[model samples]
Target chain A: MPDKEKFFEQIVRENRDKLYRICRACLADPDDAKDLYQEVLVKVWLHLHTFRGEAKLSTWLYRIALNTAILYRKQQNKHTPLLPQHISELPDASAETAHKQEQEVLLQKLHYCISCLEKQDRLIISLVLEEVSYKEIAEVLGLTVSHVGVKINRVKQKLALLMEQQAGAEIELDKADKR
Target chain B: MNFEEIQKNWQTQQAPAAEAKAGGATAESDLLVRVKVLQRKVMRTNLLVAIVISLTAVAFVFILRPLLNPNTIWYDVGMGLTLGAAFALGLLHWFKSMPWKKQVNLSSKAYVEQVLKKLHYLNTANQRLTPFFMVAILAGINLIYFDIFWNENIKLRLVMHIMLNAFMISVGAISLYYSKRHNDQSYEPIIQELEELQQKLEEV
Candidate 1:
């Protein structure tokens, strides 16, 4: 086995990217996600020895990263004051352009869909988006391969339902705006 | 939306720079690196503990041994044995209770449950064992005082002290043996429970 410090450094260097992705997905804010990224790295460093190889390291890192981000966001929301609508408006007018609106709508739908998932379901979908394999997911989550497949299917179905609902709402909003 | 559309939409968006994955290694290498890092830290901690225990044992034998009253050998031996057993038991309990190498695949629910279990185990184990061992030491001391006051032949006293020391060693050894046994028995069950929890999440 490699010396502890060297081994931890190598792990940090290796997973720094994936950890960031996890933070980005969870936090949805660049600066907050960056803070989450560093926090996850520190935790991984501290708890590195606790990683038994029963699950893939990616799964473990994902778990830690997601949990940390969620906790941080929960804390932030409790303390931070919300901005007024005018003050919070985007500086880049391009961000509100018609082309960007469509993308934002989709992103908003995706976020709402994800949030509506059961916590476990949400985690699985997030990991799936990261392109984790069923076997690795199973290992990380201690699930059987077949079980992961079934659960993932359920999550997809739920997401599809959410997307459909969002689409219906968007149509209603457009009509209301015209009226 | 179709997979292609969804994929395309997602691909077009750029996550913030700090949250981006630029040039990263494969997942397999990442896993290997993490495991190696953690193993090294644990091994170092274990080594440090072993050294401390060795030094403490040496001090007990060389320094503390001669300072006790001549009549107190039995008391010392009994105390040592009881302490040794209790310490062994405590360590074993802690090792078993730790979530180290536990299935990291806990869905949020399972993770919370595991955390609760860990806390409960720590509390219950400490509550049950610590007091009992303290009582055991008190009993041992009482037994020694009775023997010394009631039957005071020097030769018999020596025999009693030797016997008490032997008894203490036996207790310590027994505690250590049971500690190992308890750990072995619990390992598979812990892994099995974790596996089941994972399956539940996967089926979600």
Candidate 2:
């Protein structure tokens, strides 16, 4: 119950989910997303001393997450899978409700498409998906607001095209199965 | 699905239900323990570096005092220069690491540049300081040979000198080759990746 631990706990409570989403959007593997999430938290804790309210806390958090994700190199042997190893894990689709299953599928496809984008674009669109404002995304990415808009448009268009291609492939597979 | 639908789905999905590790439950305790382990590893790396530096200083102290005729003033100066070069090599790490520590707070563009800067520093340090350090050490050893072999048979001195210099030069060359190879295998790809990220960041 020290001050730093308390502060870390509160920040994690508020932002861990969104941070994980950013990781999930950037990396296709669920395990890698969790690993990236832990890496981001470690960095967040390390840099907590530097936070001076210069930017919104979530913006700061997203900056850390995206930076880590951009440069994160996966170590296969050293990965200690993060805790709460439950079935609700996104890629492990054993026990979800119907709507949950559908959402998971869509999210997985979205992750695949996100992974296919360029690295910075992945971070940009991930922030966009998190409902971060264009101005804030601009600030986090060190770009002008108009630049953020332009990039977001290009990323969205690319994402839509990728998702459509994925849907087409899925439909083609279904037709082949029926045949 | 439309982009808005995809955005809604992203927002609606729960990120693998797990609470904050505050209640001291199994996962809560486990995660905190992992973080502690990671923090401990970082501490251990720092400790190891300090130990190596202290040991290097101790080794230089031993080298400066013994195995050469202390009566010769030039020999003493040669050893001093060698130790200075070694210390300089050690201090070069500070150049590579100071910016890395501050990069956690930077924006993405700045962070990418910081990473590239660190890697470029690595290659530059390897190219320049490795030769400088090895040559200083070799020069020191060669200079001390004058006093040590002053009374030895001339043939023995000449052959031994040639052999030692040849050995040292070969070792230095092999190390430089491997250092370059190491940089290429590791830091080069990272530099390329960062540069590409930087370009992507600026593409708009």
TM-score of 1: 0.43
DockQ of 1: 0.05
Overall lDDT per candidate, in order of appearance: 0.58, 0.69
List model 1's recovered fraction of native interface contacts, to 2 decimals. 0.04
Question: lDDT tens string, model 1, A1-179?
Answer: 34755776667666676666566556544456555565576567557779898766777887777777667766666322222222224447654787776666565567556655665676677667667888877776678999999998888788788778877877787799899
What ranges in model 1 sit over 4 Å off?
A1-17, A24-35, A49-55, A66-91, A95-101, B11-204
- Model 1 Cα displacement at B203 (Å)? 41
Q: What lDDT would candidate 1 get against the real structure? A: 0.58
Cα distance off (Å), candidate 1, residue B81: 37
Candidate 1, residue B94: lDDT: 44
Best by lDDT: 2
Give the DockQ (2 decimals) of all models: 0.05, 0.13
